[model samples]
Target chain A: MTPAIAVRGLVKRYGRRTVVDNVDLTVMPGRVCGFLGPNGSGKTTTLRLICGLLTPDGGSGTCLGEDLIAGRAAIKRQTGYMTQKFGLYEDLSIRENLEFAGDVHGIADLRARVDAALDRLGLAARQHQLAGALSGGWKQRLALAACVLHAPRLLLLDEPTAGVDPKARRDFWDEIHALAATGITVLVSTHYMDEAERCHEIAYIAYGKLLARGSAAEVIAASGLVAWVATGEGADRLAIRLRDAPGVTAAAAFGASLHVCGPDQAALAAAIAPLRGAPGIVWQEAPATLEDVFIHLMRQVPDNAGQG
Target chain B: MRGTLRRMRAIIRKEVLQLRRDRLTFAMMFGLPIMQLVMFGYAIDNDPKALPTALLAADHGTMPRAIVAALGNTGYFAISHSVTSEAEADALLQRGEVQFVVTIPADFTRRVIRHERAQIAVEADATDPTTTGNALAAVEPAVARALARELTGPLAGLAPRAGPVEVVLHRRYNPEGSTRDNVVPGLLAVILTMTMVMMTALAVTREYERGTMENLLAMPIRPIEVMLGKIAPYIAIGSVQVAVVLVAAKLLFDVPMIGSLALLSAATLLFITVNLAIGFTFSTVARNQLQAMQMSFFFLMPSILLSGFAFPFRGMPGWAQLVGEALPATHFLRVVRAVMLKGAGLADIAAELAALLLLLGLVGALALARYRVTLD
Candidate 1:
């Protein structure tokens, strides 16, 4: 499949500080690419640069075979971007919002298109309700409806389900997958590990750098991390005691058990050897989970975002 | 009470620092008042002089010539054009090229020398009550004493009301000197300026403040497209306002309309667009709706004061007249009043029309240049 987006060496600097530095990204057509990053890790900036809402300080490429800088209008025409905040007019009705989106794209047969969008979102019954009055989940659905109104070839969603409930997030993911199945490329930024796991591929960015990019299992295996779980009558209490120990990257209590991970197996074992013999406690080596690797990756990237 | 005072002092300190940090706000605070003071001090004047007048002298004798010269010496009338016929003089007044036309009849010296109550007609464009009121009063006295020194021997008695010489004052266009006649036409420009600029400014600023601008810009629309779209609605609103004010002027205030309606409408549209463009430029520069509102109000204060709407245009000091000339409303006021009261044609008010067009072009270009194509 041809690439829907191909951009290299993207550099965005704000004054003396580089917000997005020497980044490269490409996602094949019809792929659901999940972007996982900590706060202010340039995910939103990168998405904006691709969609032509912002100009990159350096680097160039094509979006949908059109030059990113010169063909910005064409890129914007075929791209759907959902902002982190609800960007739809709150004063307008749901139907009105969709109609306005259609109008912005100069869509003919506006009423019919709006009707179809409303029906797809099951918002026909409350299409007359003001968008601001909708619940968080419904608002999210309305925003999604607006985003897909023009049948864009690519979608850039920035934390689309940040504050949504679990059921709503599941529903949103189901809708996203449905769109992906229809051969529309999607690039969604999220902080949720479960959401990240749902993507066809994952890209992890931290403090303006793309650190890891691959499938979930591949990312975990490539991190070279070791984790051990301890379960006993009172094993979880040892998490606090092991947190400050040398060679241990993270130690946290998971329910009545303790989950701990470190970079090297021997150092991890030595750090927990004394605790391993605790009364009635059993220590078992477990494959490190996706969250464990992500936490470990974040611990390695030095935070230079606060300076200059 | 003491605790409350301490808390209030803390808030004051915080507010002062915030005020100091906002450099633009600080500059405008000190700059606006001082600018207003200098503008008002240099430009505002109650006594207007050098009123453009047209001379149509048919009398060949010394008495009429002496009187015309005295009229010029009084510093009230500046004879800018000379006419041989009444039709030529009439055209000058209708075009609003001159405020008054002074006619010395062919029989003036003959009637005066025969002591037959010789009359001199000074027809004033009385649409502006203040401008013409003083000049008209000065005319009779000024002209009566015109040849006082030249009147020697038996002619001395002719100058001191010993013999009859009548000064026929014809206040044309508006004979009753209705303030509404002047104000109604001027309100067409003033009302449009106030509403169109502020409304368009708020509309753009609201989009930015609500974060909708990013969504709009992320689409395929250009900055010019956005500006035109934002201004289109206000154009309709401005038209409706013009209609309402026009109807009121005609029915309630009994204001006369002597000029071409189509011409007035065309000029009104141009004036409305100019103000809208100015407002749009303000929106791009302003960071928030409050700043937009303040900028609009700041612009309006000078617009209303210096546009010859509240005061006479020629009455203003030279500097104020320059500022007035810079504002669209000033030229618009001239166009509207000229067309409505004097029956000025396109040729008559070409200067005002050109000024408005120039303003529209300058402001429209500035708005497009300031409008950001990308968020960066």
Candidate 2:
């Protein structure tokens, strides 16, 4: 099967600082790929480049078999890009926003498509409500509905569920999976680990560099990091003690438990040896979580900020 | 009170910092005053001189020649066109190419020598009454002085105190010299310029401010499609405004609509589109709605002041008139006045109409070129 997004050596720079540096990303058709990255790590920029909303300063590729630069208009027609921010007309009613999106895409049977989208979103009764008046979750759902109204082949969602409630995020992810089942490719950027895990695969980026790309299990297994969880009285207090310890990459408190991870099994074991025998604390070896793997990956790459 | 003072001081400092960062607003603050001072001081002239006059001397006699020279010497009328026929002179006056048409009769010198009350017809284009008012007053005195020199040798008594030549000053089109007749038509141009440019600028910029421009650009729609779609509604709004002003002009001001309403509508539509294109161009340059509004006002100040809407077009200095000539409002004012006051046909106001069309093309192209298809 042809890859939906096949971009190589893509470089985007603002002034002297390269935002997406020599990046290569490819996602096969009908695959839901979660784009994971820290803030300002060029996740949004990379998505914009693929969807033809931005022209790369260097390198070239194809989106949905169309040249990224030359066939931008054609790519735009078949690609749906949901921006990180709400990008619909707030003053416009829910129905009107959908209709506008449909009209811009030159969708046939626009009225029926808008009505069906409204009904599917459970917004048919509130179709006349101003988009600005809706809650964050509802607004996001409406934005999703609008972007997908044209039945685009590829959906580039930039933090589509950033501020949404968990229930709404789950529903949105379910809808994304459903779209993927229908042969629609989705590349969704997100901060939520669970959302990243829901993807068929995830690409982790740090400082404009893609550090890891694989399924959740594959990424975790390949991280080469050791993790130890401790749950007992005053166990959460151990996070502060292990945070800056040599060879300890990340130490964080999760409820009454402390999760610590670092690369190199012997060094991590040596770093945590002093706290292993603390009274009323039970320490057990655990497989590194996606968060642990990402934290390890982030620390491996030097920060690119203010270097340009 | 001390706490309040410290808090107020912090707020004041914050406001100053923000104002400094908004460079466009900062520039306008200083730039607007300087511009206003320069425009008002150097450009505006109520009593305009060098009014273009066409001398149609049927009799090229010494006295007629002397009278034309005297008219030129008044520092009022500039005899730019020397036409031989009456029809040619009428066309010049009708087209607003020349302000006054001076006609010396075939029997002018013969009548003056015979003391037969020789008549010199000075027909002024009186659409702008203020422009021609002072110039008209100087005609009879200037004629008497010229004839006094000519009637020296043979007939000294023929040069009477009231002047040997009878100056028949006919204010054509607006014979009554009513201020409302001139102002009402020009007001339509001003009203449309203010609203259409401002409204369209804000409309396009609002999308940017609201973050909808990104979504709009991401869509499959072309830049021209977006531009025309944004401009189309304003054209309808402009037409409604035109109707309102035209009805008001007729009913309240009793302004004459001598030309065809259909022709006026077509020209007004063209003018509206040009302003909308200008607004779109401004929107592409401005970052937000406030900047759009400021840019609109920047264009509007000169438009209202220099377009002959408020002051006489001929009254302004050469450089200012050149600046005014480039503006769409200036050409529209000429077209509207010619059509409404003079009952001018398409051929008569064709140049101004073409000027407006050229403005629309240039501004529309600029807007399209400046409109970014990508965020880059």
Candidate 3:
């Protein structure tokens, strides 16, 4: 099957600073690819380039098999882009917003499609309510409904579940997976590790560079990272002390246990040697997690922020 | 009290910093006053001078020449067109090219010598009464002195207290010189300029500020489609406004509709479209709604003051008239007044009609040029 998105050397520069610098991305059909990155890491910019909302400074690409630059209008017709912020008109009712989306795409049987979308989202009873008056989760759901109203072949969601509650986030993910199961390609940018784990594949970017790209297991194994967990009365308190250790890349407390990971196994072990024999303390070797691999990957790249 | 002062100072400092960052608002704060000052002080004149007058000299004798020279000496009537026939003079007056037409009848010198109460027809275009009021007053005195100078020797006794030469001043189109007739029609132009330009100016800027512009642009819609969609509703609103004002002018103010209603409607639609295009152009240039409002105000200030809606168009200085000539409101005001007050036909107001169309094209082009299809 042809890839839904195939872009190479994707570069976008805002004046002196390059926001998306020589990065490439490809996503096959019917896959949920999570886009992971630090704040202001050009994730939104990259998504906009793929959706033909922004022209790349020095790159060529195809989105939904249409030329990114020359066939932007055609690309826009087949792709659904949900901005980081709620992009639907708040002054309009839920039904009106959905109908407007349908109108823009020239969807046939718009009323019936809108009715089905409202019913599927459980927003039928409140379809006349103003979009602005809805709760954050409901507003986000309405936005998602509007995005897919045209039955697009590809969906690009930028941090769609950023401010929602845990239950709503879970439901949103279930909905996303349901859409993916229908053979629609999805490229969703998110910061939550749990959300990233839910994707079929993940791509991590930091400071305008794509650092890691693979499945959860493949990425963790390829990081060459070794992790050690310590659980005791005060094992969590050692996080601050091990954080600045020379060989330890990331040290954090998960509940009452301390998890530490680093690229070099012996160096990481030496960093925890003094506390190994502490009273009632237990040490166990463990496989590195996706978060650990991402933390390790983030450390290797120098921050290029504020130089813009 | 001391803590309150410190908190107030901090708030003031923050406000000052934010104000400095908004460069458009900062510039407008200073630019608006300076522009108003320069326009009012240098360009505006209530008692206009050098009003253009056309002279139809049927008798090219000494008396007619003397009267023409004296009218020129008054510094009010400038004989810019010297026509040979009455029809040519009437055409000049109807087109608003000349403010007054002076007709010297045949055998005027013979009648003056015989003391036959020689009458010179002075027809003034009084659609804008204020513009012609002072010029008309100056005509009788100027002609009296000119005839006095000519009534030497045998014609000396022909000059009497009432003056031997009768100045029959006909205030055409507006015999009563009603200000309502002038102002009511002009209100249509002013109201349309204020509302149409301002409403469309906020259209795109509101979308931008609300963050909906990205979604709208991400869709499959074209830029022209967006512009037309935004402008079409405002055109309907403008038509309703025109209807309301026209009814009020007819019923309350008793302003006559002497010309074709169809013609007025066509011209009003064109004028509304022009203003809407201008407002759309402002929306493209402005970054936010506040800046859009300021831009609309900046455009509207000169439109109301310099367009002869509030003041006299011919009374302004040459440079000010040039500025007014470029504004759509100026041409629309002329069209409305000519259509309603003077019963002007299409051929009579053809120049103003063409001017409005040209303004529409230029502003439409500018709006389309500024509209960006992508965020870049």
Q: What do the candidate models score in CA lDDT, each in turn? A: 0.84, 0.86, 0.86
Ranking by lDDT: 3, 2, 1
Model 2, runs deviating above 4 Å: B1-161
lDDT digits (tens) for residues B146-229 of candidate 3 = 988888897777775674787798988877666667776877887788777877888779889989999988988777777876
Which stretches of candidate 1 lie above 4 Å from their native place? B1-170
Q: How many clashes in candidate 3?
A: 0
Better of 1 and 3 by TM-score: 3
Per-residue alpha-carbon lDDT of candidate 2 for residues A207-253, written as tens digits (9 for 90 to 100): 88888998999999888888999999999999999999998999999
The docking category that best describes candidate 1 is: incorrect
Candidate 2 residue lDDT tens string, B1-376 = 3423332333233224334554774464345333433343345555688999998888998889999999999888998999999999999999999999999889998988887889999999999887898899999889989988988867888875664887798999998666667777887787788878877787778878989888878888767666766676567667867776787677766889999889999999999999999999999889999999999999999999999988889999999999999999999999999999999999999999999999888988899899988888
TM-score of candidate 2 on Cα atoms, chains taken together = 0.78
Per-residue alpha-carbon lDDT of model 1 for A159-239, expressed as tens digits?
999999999999999999999999999999999999999999999988888999888989988999999999988999999
* Leading candidate by DockQ: 3
Pairwise DockQ winner, candidates 2 and 3: 3
State the DockQ of every prediction.
Answer: 0.21, 0.24, 0.25
DockQ agreement of candidate 3 with the native complex: 0.25
For residue B110, give model 2's deviation from the true position in Å: 42
Worst 10 residues of 2 chain B by lDDT: B6-15
TM-score of every prediction relative to native: 0.77, 0.78, 0.78
List all candidate RMSDs to the true structure.
15.2, 14.6, 14.3
Q: What clash pairs does model 3 have?
A: none
